[model samples]
Target: MIHHHPDSNMMLEYASGSLNWAHSLVVSAHIQLCPKCAAQMKLLNGIGGTLLAASEPVTAAPTPADSFERLMARIEEDTDASPAAQQVGERQTTAARTRSRKAKRDPIFASVPPVVEKLLSTNPVLPWRRLSKGLKEARLTTGQNRHEVAFHRIAPGSKVAEHDHRGKEITMVLYGSFSDAEGVYSTGDFLVREPGEVHRPTATQNQECLCLSVVEAPVALTGFWGKLINPFLSIRPS
Candidate 1:
């Protein structure tokens, strides 16, 4: 069961489509694993729809003829495109989505949502690089500034270097469990750490832990060794 979740404000932002793309993606994945958040999102969506329906109509809008002309021009451009190439692209996208859906149903990755799976599918063989003896990470390209998303794997009973965030950091446990100074976090837990918050995360003894993490800025290590490697350990976009 999920013991942690995104704060109410974050959830509200996600529901209202106010979150950044990277943050939204992580929240979306968490919603799939969390029934409570999913229900909350549903309620928010309903509220949004109601508000939209009650809103006043625009005084003026683009003419239908202009829209039709633009549509026709787009169709003409598409007609000039290669059908075979389009078919191949469509097939690849469909296959990836199907595979992602199937993966979500599997027990091994039950916490992984379709969106996360689909994004990871783009790079089937992720080259996980070692951050430390027992810690490894694989960065994901999110095309966003001042933030990054990545997957991190920690060996059982291993502890990450103690550090304090320079900005904001969010971590979602995807597999196994880990613990920090605050508390122990299990699968599906959404943890948020802000600038000036410091903690050392250690994986549980029973199994390895995998987490999807997003950080807005590089972290500042607290120890001598951590400080020595902090520059190299900084998370970067792929």
Candidate 2:
């Protein structure tokens, strides 16, 4: 069961169509696994549309610049750069093809879903080092944005430090379960926590867990390690 839906802020952004394509893709993927967030997103969409329609329309003077000219200039620039772009593009293409062949040769990765496979095709492995007891994590920077997402692997029977969040946090369980004060989350469960919420999350016995998490800012850790971890560990923004 998805105990905590995405926090109000993310849903609000989604309703207003403010999410970037890459992050939106992750949210959409989570929505597929979470009915609660799906429902909330739908509601936010309706509410936002209604609010917009309810407001009075205001007319403004059009800008003097010609949009067509701007588009034509951009197209011309792209055309001029196409050769160099193609060279880089070709190199990346060859690399991807080589990787695909390698993946096909690997038996363990053969059964991965095409969507996940396609997504991971270009993703390089992060510097996965141990964070705490039985836990390892790595951060991913989706392009040049301040927002960063992370992938976490928690060994079963392991517990993390009790900590408070600094911003919004969204978590989707891909495998196994993690428990906190609210409830336990199993595979496909989604949890969206608001800022200032505190919890010590621990995995259940028997198996390790895989989770995808996104944070806007960073979480505030409270111990001696927390001071050190705070500098390195990123969390969602408040």
Candidate 3:
């Protein structure tokens, strides 16, 4: 069973198509992996449609075409879509949201969710960039300037250096389990860290840990090497 998940507000935003693409990808992957979250998404989608149907639309003189098109597009979704089919399409909208053109920029490159594989494939093949002894990252150019997104893999029994966030950081485990000072997160777990929050995460000795991360800003690593690296750690351009 999954132990952590995005909050209700985050789920609502994702359901309503208002969430940013970067974070939405994390949530999208989580929903695909967790049946419980996927079910919640269906519920939220229904509630959103009902509320939207009952509410009045803004008829401002300069109503944006894209906004109006989105509203009409959502309103046009077949009310009778099958549960099985809807389940399959859960991540499709997310894939669409991430469709913007980027200005720039495995084994665990295998076995990830299809959406993840699809998005990462759009960029050139990149060698896994080692961040520390046991931690390696594969970056993704998700069109946002502030959010730096990537997949991180930790070798079994390895510990990521302790660190605090400069801005918000959200992590979703895709495989195996890892424990932080807060708790142990397993597959499908969603974690969020706010500015100044600190923790050290260690991959369980039993298996390698792989995760997807979306950071609003770079992290402020906590020790000697971390401090040395912090000044140079800036969000990469999308």
Candidate 4:
């Protein structure tokens, strides 16, 4: 069960389409695993629809037939200009999407939502950087954005390095559970850590924990060793 969730304001942004793509991707994944949030999202969507219906409609836009013709003409022009190129592009896309290793058979990862599955289609699961004992990280890309997104996997009963965020960091528990100063975040829990807040997360002993994390800036370590290497961690915001 999820014990934590994004605040009302963030959810409002997500429902209204104001959140950035990177954070939106993680939030969407959390909403998939969390029925409570999913229900709330449905309500929010309905409210948005109601508001839109009450507003004045755009009467100056092109007609459906005109838009359809223009869209079809553009597609035909592109296809005619590079049929072979389009075919090759489609093939490459198919291969990339099918490249997921454990997403199909592995129970731990099989439940990944489509938003995250798309990223894994190209990122792969290997080559994880063993940042610390029993902890590994694999960065995922959601275009060139201000936020840095990644998957953090922690072995059972292992504790992560104590650290504080330089900017807001949102984490969604994808599998298993992890506990920090605030509380234990089980599967589907979405929690936010603000700048200067300190916490050390430790995975539950039953199973390993996998979390999707989105950080606006690099984290600063609170421990001695963390202090030494903190200088090397930096985010070049785009």
Give a tens-digit lDDT track for model 3, residues 1-238.
7989999999987887777667777888889888888999999989888998999996654323334334333433422234555765765664454343222223553546655655565544654799899999878764446577887899999999899898889999988889988999998899989999999999999899989898888888898888678888887745
Model 3's lDDT to the true fold?
A: 0.76
Highest-TM-score candidate: 4
Model 1 compared with the native: what TM-score? Answer: 0.78
Q: Write the per-residue lDDT of candidate 2 for residues 29-111, one digit (tens) a residue.
A: 56766778778888887888899899999875432123323433443453233555568777677667756765754242343
Of the candidates numbered 3 and 4, which has the greater TM-score value? 4
Could you report the Cα RMSD, in angstroms, for every candidate shown?
Answer: 7.7, 8.3, 8.2, 7.5
lDDT of 3 at 145: 62
On a 0 to 100 scale, what is the lDDT of residue 102 in model 3? 24
Per-candidate clashes come to 0, 10, 2, 0
Candidate 4 segments whose C-alpha is farther than 4 A from its true place: 57-107, 236-238
Query: Model 4: C-alpha RMSD to truth?
Result: 7.5
Q: Give the per-residue lDDT of model 1 (tens digit) for 1-238.
A: 8989999999988876667666776787899899999999999999988997999976655543344335334444433344555687776776676566557553445547655665555545666899888899888764445568888999999999888898898999999999998999988899999899999999999798989988988888897876686777565653
Query: TM-scores of all models?
Result: 0.78, 0.62, 0.77, 0.78
